[model samples]
Target chain A: MLSIPARRTNDVTPSEITPREVFERRRDFLGTAAGFALGTALAPLSAALASEKPLASIKSPLSTPEKPTPLKDVTSYNNFYEFGTDKADPALHAHTLKTRPWTVSIEGLVKQPKTFAIDDIFRLGALEERIYRLRCVEGWSMVIPWLGLPLATLLKSVEPLGSAKYVEFISAADPKTMPGVNRSVIDWPYLEGLRLDEAMHPLTLLALGLYGEVLPKQNGAPLRLVVPWKYGFKSGKSIVKIRLVEKQPQTAWMKANPREYGFYSNVNPEVDHPRWSQASERRIGEFLKRKTLPFNGYADQVAPLYAGMDLKINF
Target chain B: MAWWFALSQGKRHVGLFKIALFAVCLIPLLRLVWGAWNDTLGANPIEFITRSLGSWALNFLLITLCVTPLRKLTGWNWLLQLRRMLGLYVFFYASLHLSTYLWLDKFFDWQEIVKDIFKRPFITIGMSAFAMLLPLALTSTKGMVRRLGGLHWQRLHRLIYVIAICAVVHYWWLVKLDVSLPAIYSVLLCILLGFRLLWPGQGRRNVISGNFKPAQE
Candidate 1:
């Protein structure tokens, strides 16, 4: 039987939470012995808290029936250019990232502009597991079980001013820590943004962990955003700053190639990228390319957000 | 260098060299098959296959380009004998690369596939390059060479230079950054094409005295 832990509202006691390294070691052990009955029995329960179901009261009707992508593929195949441009570079190079003593600054047009420690953010609301379909702009998709609170919970606490129209997320860019920052792969300190309402969507996640354990550094440790309806790059990783702005802020990819990547990178199959068709995507674990869905199959929920707007122009 | 001399000795040895080159060319495809058999194509097997075949196609193009310059430099006039086979392998790998996209990636959705060819810049360039290669491949046979006559066939085959440029551009535009690999290919192509420009008639003697005589008849 799968055990869905009741959502915890209060601060998690340190003793109850296992260290990331210990959890990873246990996972490696389990993976090696996964062919055995014992490993098979404990596999789903151990890896993720939410096994094919959303947490109680999370209201995730957009979730897919697809099994979550294996932890190996999820961790290994990533496009976090802060580590390197190659998909595997993050997995190899992100270990040097120090995620513990992290803080996020909420500035710009917010009424209560302040920096919050990682712990303080964790204590804002109950952490719940949400299984979401993460679609990349490169025409690949993955089902991920993310552990985090909704972005709305954090935004409400920040108290954005009436003038605030866009919310920008800035990722960490310490060159000493992230070697890829030294290279001119992208403009340093990666930036992503969403409209104020989009940021406040129930599906928008401020993720801190994945697979029941603390997030692997490659998978964006300490803090990240998971905007399920948008392209994966819109979900900035290792986020250090959240700035509420009056106008649409420039995002990293859009700045790099505006024709290819737009500010509103909603997963619309009809709007093809300049380099490739977006009508279909290969799910990471699956062999066949599945037809891509508008808004990554979250259209029923997110389509209203872009109602009457041309997605092709927005994209 | 020693192996080139040994392999270039006589007609029988030249035949042996062609067989050896054929086996050597099959290694990459064989390795891919082995990788598939071992379930080692990584998380996205289709992507792995697609990228591998595309890269092999480009690599073979580079190798095909190298043959003319190598024949000119080495004076191993028999080296010209392998050019047809090397050129054919470029078409082979390129055909596989296109088939991977058409069959495996798109599943023969001709409407979407045709839309992709027309819509995407990279696909447009790649499809054009493949289209150019088709005539060159069709006319590669000895019988067709006789039908077209020598000068016309050579002129027609010169379309390869354009195809090579298109192939490099296809790769360059497709990559999202870190263009070191494509840059290397571009520089190598420049050197090969540049050599041809710098020394126009230098290779004519070698071609006349070499195996190209029989094909001219």
Candidate 2:
């Protein structure tokens, strides 16, 4: 019963970011690169493909250095819904989700709980980009470079009550905007939560961006929680509210089918999903023979948290 | 028609014709395997190929099972001649699909595989379907048909109906979104099954039963 969900951080997301802003950023970036290399020795290829530059190389939406590490297969295949809803079409579909003028409504057991706009929250702490592997409960995993500040530092502002047992997250659920949310596959206003102790964990991040750029829409732009220890879905996407709860909250997936998805959704291969096997997962870009690590190779840091409890029962 | 005539005329190269027909049947399988080798089988190629072959197996099995009912409805018995071959081809592709999952996806991980059989809903249904198909394929030969007798053989073959349902369930569970294809397949299966239910024993059996009253035999 290692509850990794609560250990996730709350991020200060951008209030002014938009899809148009991202597109313009790409245009300006390519424009600047194209300008600098106009008269150099290898200028012929650049000149020939100047007009069709964006089409030439599939540019990663996040920023990379001049000689950045070529991305591995895993993190590149993301499923952050704040960015977009497509399993395969994340970066492209995320363009439709508006991330600006965003406000996170904080309520429940917090001492000074209030609805703060994105700017006010982001101004409280510095954002950092850290790469982490995001493994889904559905048995597919990805590695992503995320930019966000830690949850503990941000929690200082909200001032959690001493009785606060769990912190619950609620994602936006406007069916007109989120077409996928309209479907009844899982309950709308996707909910996930973490224990207070887990939420206070230093590794938990509230992500703002990826690849050194403003967070892409498909990668949960604006704001989303990042719990590196738990399965990816436990880190809820497209968040709109943070309620500090005295009791454990009923989450979206658990509400849909309590028998399959437990609230403490630690990535344990031993406990098979009711509909599929968790014994093995396909690491997004890797070969089939690659053995899925226990707790996704983070057992060293987080395994001690669940020492006395029976995982089988909690699962 | 020409090929049928040639066979009726007792042509010397009738075996060659049968071989060519067999090769023609093999073409779709050939193309699919080629696509797989060329790395063009879409995202998650193994799953795609495995599922494709599995669905085709179910389709061909349903088609084979429909032959007798179809012949009864149309007053034509020639369709029965194609049933055995079609049934065996269905088994062949079903085996291929199962083997692909076992070898490629699971890497023959027996413990995990066993866990999947009981734990996963889709895999549970799929494995049951495959298990039923195994007996059907094993008893397909002429010797087994004679040993089992016609009545027992027909009884044993009715297991295919259960297999068909299980196969459909297996397909429906695997889909992440847009269940339109699975819904269509189920409806098609219903119609196929519905034809048999609506028009059972309507051809030569009716004529014989009419003449003999209680003693049609």
Candidate 3:
């Protein structure tokens, strides 16, 4: 059974799942007392700390009587291509990407510019579990249990100056390291940006891990953004730099094809991608009949932020 | 003396040729399994394994179909000797691809599996192509050939044409954007089929088939 966030009861919610949820759920699936025992033994060190941290609270507009899509479906299929790029090739390719010794550089419109190693950044805020529905521009949706600190917490540390209107995320780009980047498909150093207000949203997360584990390379290990309200690509992976700007920042997909991938890529069915329709999305776990949700069911949590604006024009 | 020697030598090479062909067909399957174990099967191993096997199946099928045309155009009848192995390789990879989907993707839930096969247009075509290839594989042996008889064997093998078309459609529909790769495969298929249509037994039949023996004087 689902409890819909009261603001808008009409939107859809992705099935909620996290890696920690998966470890608990695997007991029945693994079908062995010994397996459960082993999981229990492993849970304290691996699962306890992971489950203890609560992420930003997300409100969904839709409610249903059905159980959310199980954790198994959520973690198995993912689209984080920075680990490796291939619609179907990431799971295998991600294993090879190295996530250690990561450093994130902060530049643009900040009162104090700083570069910090991943470990140093993790020390800034306690982890929280934010379960949000992730909608991909490619018409597939998932409810992810992301384990990370809020974007606001990190932003406050940097102290964006009044002039900072937008914040841009730049992913690491070494063609030799990322084969997909070698090809001029969507531009190397995949870029994404958010308005300062959106960047400061509590729901905006700099996720370091998912499913109760260090982020698998396939799922953007080391670090990635998890902007639940916008399309998943806006949550750029393998992030190396955060740039503040006065005007709207030019994102990669927008620069590559301005008409198709807008910077404000909200999950709107009304605005069809010139190449495909956004009217429907395949829920990652639903076999035959997954339906689409407007704003991925976050209208209650963040929609008011855009209350007076024309969604289509802004979109 | 030459005619007698040619007859004896032709009979001698038949068994060895068949062995060579069988070896060629087994290599790809062995390589795939080996790659899987080694973690060299790419980032999304399951998808990589599935798609690779599917592509190889299609490739082998295309090569098998190309046999008659190549034999007719180049007068290299030995090419026909490899067709059985190539056709079998198609079955080998097609079976692996389907099994991976069943075991890995669907997890062998028969009801849902059947539902997906029926519901998804791409899966429908891909499954149909695989289903059509099964009988051809079942009748691959010399014993089965003898059992089916010459005319029946030829008739059953014609299903490859239908399978080829379905395979191309399966690929074309799956691609999201930049249809170039699928388009390239479709063009190659058209050319292969074109060869069959353009030269339907118009060229030499190769009754001698490289076992040339002058008429005994």
Instruction: Name the candidate that leads on TM-score.
Output: 1
- The candidate that wins on DockQ is 1
TM-score of chain A of each: 0.81, 0.73, 0.77
Which regions of candidate 2 deviate over 4 angstroms?
A: A1-86, A89-94, A116-124, B1-43, B62-86, B111-124, B139-152, B172-184, B200-217
- How well is each residue in B126-152 modelled by candidate 2, as lDDT tens digits? 999989988989998878877876666
lDDT of 3 by residue, B1-217 (tens): 9854653454347567677668877777777677666645432345566677788888887888887787676565555666777788888878887887776555677987776677667888998999899999999888887787655676688789899999989887765434667788899899988887677553224322433221111
Clashes of each: 0, 13, 11
Fraction of native Cα contacts reproduced by each candidate: 0.52, 0.18, 0.00
Residue-level lDDT of model 3, residues A116-220, one tens digit each, is: 888666655545455567788877676666667678877888889999999999988766656666666566678889999998986788887665456666677
lDDT of 1 by residue, B61-119 (tens): 88888877877776666777888888899998899889888887888989988888887
Ten residues in sequence with the least summed lDDT for candidate 3 chain A: A1-10
Output the lDDT of residue A33, model 2.
Answer: 51
- Cα error, candidate 3, residue A19 (Å): 16
What value does the lDDT take at residue A217 in candidate 1? Answer: 96
Model 3's chain B yields a TM-score of 0.81
Residue B29, candidate 3: C-alpha displacement in angstroms: 15
